[model samples]
Target: MKKYTLLLLTIAATVVILIQSILYIKAGASAGKTSGVPAESLARLSEQVSVRAARRGNPWINLRDGRDLVAELTGADQGLLAGEGLAEPMALASDDFDEDGTPDLVTAHRAAQGGVLSFYRGNVDAVYPNAPEAKARKAAGSYTDAPFLSPGRLLATAEPPDLLGAGDFDADGHRDIVAAARGGSSIYVLSGDGRGGFPRSKQIQLPGRVTALTAGEINRADGLADIIVGISTQDGARALVFEDLRGAIKAAPESHALPATATDFALGDFVDGYETDLAIASGSQLLVLHGRDRRSAKQSRPRITSRRFSSAIESLATGNFTGSHRFEVGVLSEEGEIAALTPVKVKSKN
Candidate 1:
């Protein structure tokens, strides 16, 4: 009876050890697999939320919705909102307005006095920038998706401005603004101080109704930016190039005539390897002034080459949005809708 009882006790110990060993192997196998949700699910979620950003070498030209950016800048004000307002985008430019590492937007307000230079500072370093992050942070008792308008100051203007232009006018490694007044009485050249302030206003007298205004290194050798404006005349539209002669600014005694029926114009290298090419949107035609030099005392004019478009282009924004190192022209309709047009070399009749 004692031997049988000892054997029974040993058997019970062996059974408990075997059960523990089976549980350990099962737990190890489970640990080897994912805890919850699979890798494929995460990839699908990423695909649903994100888009393929366009990078260099592969050009993707499509209409992108800018309402979110606009809303962040002007909460309730929709007057200057692009795609809604006809003359919404007076000037669309990017710069580090707040001296931040990321670039910010500088555009006009759609109000009557909108030309006073409205700046939308970049929100690159925001805490709760996305939806998921915002939701999580909100549950944790703290949440913020930080501000787009970072301490904006409206540089006082005499009258409402019709057009806004920017360049390193002072050549002080900072961007200076050139605003053409709506009344055609004054053209204000406010020099930027790297901070979002223009203490002094160097107002210049205008010749006539200037439709468009922009700045570029019109004088190649000088390497300093010069102010260029489009003048509406009896015959047609004209390009009035003004050179920044250090302190004071000087323009051609007479305005250079653009292509037939020129409505608006902007300075850009529309052609590759050419600098300061004039791009004029005349009615429904896109004209490029190739191999032109505006620095000459003897009336420097651009050689006009044009392409016909389906609809009239109201304004021009020149930049490399298509991953091209060279500049691409973004045309806006009267309705403020924008579409990018890439430049191609066209052979003229010899």
Candidate 2:
């Protein structure tokens, strides 16, 4: 018949080239197993979530349902590279203190002769690496001062003093410890006795030179906890809002004014949700202080609604990446270039 019909058309063109080379090797091994991660572990988990959203900027507002959060600090080589820290990172607010709801990290170390508070006990994943420098110098030598050495004079190596939140300032619900003393105007309060110890009690003092502290409940009042202190003299930046009652502190007309040099301050809500709003970082801008109706007749003051980065804003944090609650301003330049402002949507109404 014509050579068996040309050998059955060359065996059906070699079975359609062997089924397209086995579907091109199974589509390149399913694209290497669907993007197989590992680009240096996704750039070290995007630099540890951009260095924990540029250092503690989400100053807590509920959060403890699934809880896995971890953020610990150490000055990062002390050039004061970002938010100027030789020490000052004591935050614990999401409740659970170790009952296991997960939210624990209370730090304080100004050791020359006086401060060294540390209590970290929350682990579902990690954040434990701190209590072993000879057991934090034997629990800071049973306090009374003996472990704060450094050219001493009452332990003066200074620079580590600015942490301003942890709750229950002595209504005895638990959590307590608030700090801020870069040159002192007083606001220390450390009272935790629910079982993990924190003796030092009160010291409110404020008028100027305090620079950044945050905590809020702002008159929605459940048991009281609202203090926002952020002074800085030469009569320019201000933010004192105090109202704690249990540990005692009154002054609350809800002040707010800034233009240059405020560095960092946070208390969220953003606007018109009518509760918390006071995010100031001034000096490359980002200010949004709205909270009127203390009986409102007039008193709005606090405009500048975000002008992020002309450079010179060492820190200001409140993050969500892009999933929700924005405003993540952190800029460290003098030639370090960290950059991150994110939170855009403006047209007017500063």
Candidate 3:
């Protein structure tokens, strides 16, 4: 008798929820009708709800929100050796090195002579305002990689350093270069002069070989950007936050230990917070560390080789590649291949 009563209550509660939802939607529809919205518009709104229900099952697919986005690998750089592995450092720089209106893709390879930076200019027609910028360009030779400046380059290099994270380091309205030394406690800074050139680089000394870098306002409220870098240590990995105090960017007095030899560091609000959180790939695994808002981070035991979560990730970045408020992960595999993973929707187990 008690079980029967409980079942009846559950059914009644579900019916009430359904009726409330229906009435709420109808109220909205009635408002649209009062505002002289056509029945076709309301039907489209109803279709959108059905579409969203279908989208919840597969987050990998792009939205049907009237955007012409196709979720697929549209292009790849086959000739350039992205990297031998995480051991070998390489970077793909996407920016307008010359401050031109068009975007350019710079390819950096670590060399004995400091390092070498090359450019591949983005197609102006593909990016120009008069032209429509589709997610996938379809014109003949539309998406080919061409040498950007014929011969313009950074000319600055590092100690086999894999430096990335480009931004306006000085609020100078020009893109600047930030990188970490993989074998030392130094961070390289090169100020772009708006042209396809940079001034003599400056070094911000930290602790250990700086392997990873992600730029944001990690420390300052002055509206300028700061940086967070990952360094390898004898114990594990430590993250150093450098804020742009005044006009000059300086390293924070101390660092925090993030264990397991961090590599490919990224920043986002992973676990719900106003400040940013950290994500890294280390030893064939992805690690998420809470931000300063939390007391500490969750630590897990190392998994076996066969059950490894990643294929020895060489690099990674997080962004909302799709048309959603949520972000996505792009990983560089050890075999010099790039992989993009859309966040999957999984039901929580109570």
Best by TM-score: 1
Task: Give the per-residue lDDT digits (tens) of candidate 1, residues 115-182.
Answer: 44566555432422443433443355333233343333344355555667666676677766777754
| RMSD to truth, every model | 18.5, 22.6, 16.8
Give the 10-residue window scoring lowest on summed lDDT in candidate 2. Answer: 144-153
Model 2 scores a TM of 0.25
lDDT values of the candidates?
Answer: 0.56, 0.50, 0.52
The list of candidate 1 runs beyond 4 A from truth reads 1-92, 110-116, 123-149, 182-185, 219-223, 234-236, 245-254, 259-261, 292-301, 308-312, 317-350
Name the better of 2 and 3 by TM-score.
3
What ranking emerges by TM-score with the best candidate at the front? 1, 3, 2
Best by lDDT: 1
Candidate 2 wrongly placed segments (more than 4 Å): 1-164, 167-175, 179-185, 194-199, 202-212, 215-229, 235-280, 287-317, 323-350
True lDDT of residue 249, candidate 2? 48
Residue pairs with backbone overlap in model 2: 57-317, 111-148, 112-148, 112-155, 113-155
Cα error of candidate 2 at position 84, Å: 42
User: What does candidate 3 score on TM?
Assistant: 0.54
